[model samples]
Target chain A: MTPLRIVTQLLEIAAALIAAPAFLGWVNQCRAWLQNRRAPSVLQPYYGLRKLFGKDVILAENASALFRFAPYAVFGTMVAAAAIIPSMGTGLPLSTAADAIALVGLLATARVFVSLAAMDVGTAFGTLGARREMMVGFLAEPALLMVLFVAAMISHTTSLPLIAEGLTTRALALYPSLAFTAVAFTLVLLAENARIPVDNPATHLELTMIHEAMLLEYSGRHLAMMEWAAALKLFNYACIGFALFIPWGTGTEAGGPAALMLAAPLLALKLAVAGAGLAVVETLSAKLRVFRAPEFLATAFLLAVLGLLVYLLLGA
Target chain B: MAPLSFDLQLLNGCAALLLLLSFSMLSQRRIVNLVNLLALQGALLCAATLLVAVRTGQGHLYLSAVLTLALKVVGLPLLLHRLIRRLNVYWDAEPVINASGTMLIGLLIVVFAFGLAQPISALASTATRSTLGIAIAVILLAFLTMITRRKAMSQVVAFLSMENGLFFGAMSATYGMPMVVELGVALDVLVAMLVLGVFFFQIREQFDSLDLHHLESLKETE
Candidate 1:
């Protein structure tokens, strides 16, 4: 890779890391506004992260070493995922590892580590959360793979960058398969990110919460890392969505560094519309019962499979 | 195959939406939602027919599209809504198989339909021929919905969806049947619907509920 390209990639990664929490803050603000509540500042997540990093971590009486290390592991995996997903350009050097299937694997690894650490301290809420989290991951992972598989079949490649580039430059863009997979991927995204209608990100009910349940035992920097990683995970998912469904603004098939520069504002615009759409969806739907989550994921899985079938039948 | 033009893509999207609506109906236990899903499916079928008509320059297909719009989208859903209100069978307690299991089977059926149509789709020269597999999938899913559902009204909904799938399959495979055949089928559907409306009251009068499980008791007694 050229030095200029490498520098551009690093800048993209850093921009993502810095912008991740702000994206979360934006979604929250939009959700608050839609719900007719006083909105929190768009910098709320940053302030929360800073305050979290400065506090002291409390240890459980029977805390294991794994509990101490899981935050870093999850945070590192999220960073790896963000690096691999093309934010502004699809041809970053790390794009080689940006196979959408492999990205799912990375997310699963982070999930497993966090769950293992959740159960390490022998807390009831921690165990409950970990169990629920694994269940969601188990169902969601296949639906995600199926979504990627449909996109891969369309572009005839498994590499995310190549898929993005190919789809961006392809002729006759009204793909029925892409349309079906987009719907499926949206469902998977909501479930994976602990968004509404699956698990409420903002909820902390003892019997219902999934992500927050796992973090009940974490404190200080570890808590900050976990929370920050979650935000980064959300950002990565949005980037992945852009790369697949709306890869036009990406600099992959366009001019060199200048295209990358232009892509930033476009990315922000897509994210703004996407985040507000997410908020409206969250505002509209109620959470399903824990038992009903499988059916929800099943709908996603079936939709993804149907997309594949459409591609196979229609060759679109 | 015809070129992947905007109209063809729009037709394919309509088929995909139809398939989705079929699965939605299969999983739905609320009668209101099931009826709504059926109406949506009818609307999609109307849209697909209109698209096929416009793209192929077939004048007859336009009449069929209007028929689908009037009968399936407007007439049947309105009739079903009134049937539901009068019969008070708004909640389907459960199905023979659960919602998710029905969906899993429905997915397999779709795959099977595509496989079944792969060879046939190759020989067909229609502009919308690619959607034949989806039409078949829609047909089988409607049948599955019929078999698994407990309520008789939903069974009737599933039956209408089956006819819808047949209509869509015919249109995709051959640009629709002769106009005479289309008119006859539409008349048959209206008659069957009216007859079933009468049958529902007879059965409900006898059993005090529309659940078809009550019919099993009428079998030969030892």
Candidate 2:
């Protein structure tokens, strides 16, 4: 691997690792502001993580080895996801493995591990949460793939970095297909990240909770790892969205690692804007009933497929 | 290439927005929101027509765009809102099919429209010919909305949306029809809306409800 490529890859992963929690905190702070509550510090997640990490582990009575292993597996997979997304540069050594299908597979792997761990505890809420999470996963995955397919179709390759690079270098033009896919991708992002109108990330009420219900059995560092992984997943998804839609700042390969360095502030700016938009969406809409989650995701899927059709029809 | 003397990308963006507005109207249950979506559709149609007019140097299309803004966007929606107020049909009852099923059918109709428009799009020479499939899809989806909806006001909105799709189809395929024909069609649509508005009152008076289901009882028994 070229030294610059390797450095850019590591830089991207490390930045995502550090910024993920901050991104979550930003969204939470924005939500609090929009709801007219006193806003928390944007560093609130880091404070919570520090507190959680310093505590001792406490596990369920019948916790299996799998329960102990899932948190690390999930965290590792999200980091791996972050590594491949080309947020800082389009010429990473890991770009070979950054195929859109492979990226989807990595995400699915993390979801599987988390769901399996949730069911391992055997609590009623745990199993219920696992079921709901799986339902969302299956429904959202196809839409996610369809979103990527439209991008891939345009770039004539399934590789994420290549798509971003292709779009960056091409002359400016509007792809109606991209417009349609963007709406679909936003819907998928909201659902996959347990955001509003699908599942409320803030809800802890037993009957209504989906993501939180799964983590009720974990405590201490394990819980911290799981929460960190959740944040990283959101960060990674946001980066993917950036890579697909607003890929301008990442720069073409001829610009080199200097361009990668230049991308950092732009990435931060995008995260800030996207996080605020997410908060606005969550504030404006109520969570759908659990039964309606399928319909919500179904609409996302249809919109993504509509993007593909638009691409085909317009040949754009 | 001097950028073709017009923004083709802007035209495509407008076409995409028109399709999205169509989908929003299809899924909307509130009569008021459906009327608003129809007006939004008209605005996008006007924008697309203006783009084509600029590209082709056809002065008639500009007149058509202004007509669209005045009639479809302003007049029809205002008329529909008054009908909704007078008829007092605010919320549509449960559609004949659920939202998810309706979306699935709409998706199929879109695919079929693309397939059907393929040969025609190839033969057409206009800058917006590629949007022909979307125009046809809009028409069919509007038709689908009419079939699945239960309220008279919603059906009227869907009918106007269908007219929008037809107008879009004509624009994409031929840069627009002859001005006389376009004006004649606009008058026809305005007259049709008025007649439909009167029928809304007659139906409400006869059946005491705006739900088309009320008229079903009057169907000749087998």
On DockQ, the candidate that comes out on top is 1
lDDT accuracy of residue B12 in candidate 1: 77
Candidate 2 chain B has its poorest 10 consecutive residues by lDDT at: B1-10
Candidate 1 A-chain TM-score: 0.98
Candidate 2 Cα errors over 4 Å, as ranges: B1-6, B218-222
Alpha-carbon deviation at A59 in model 1, angstroms: 1.7
Model 2: docking quality category = medium
| TM-scores, chain B, all models | 0.96, 0.95
- Global lDDT of each candidate: 0.89, 0.90
Per-candidate RMSD, Å: 1.8, 2.0
> Model 1 TM-score?
0.96
lDDT of 2 by residue, B181-211 (tens): 9999999999999998889889888878888
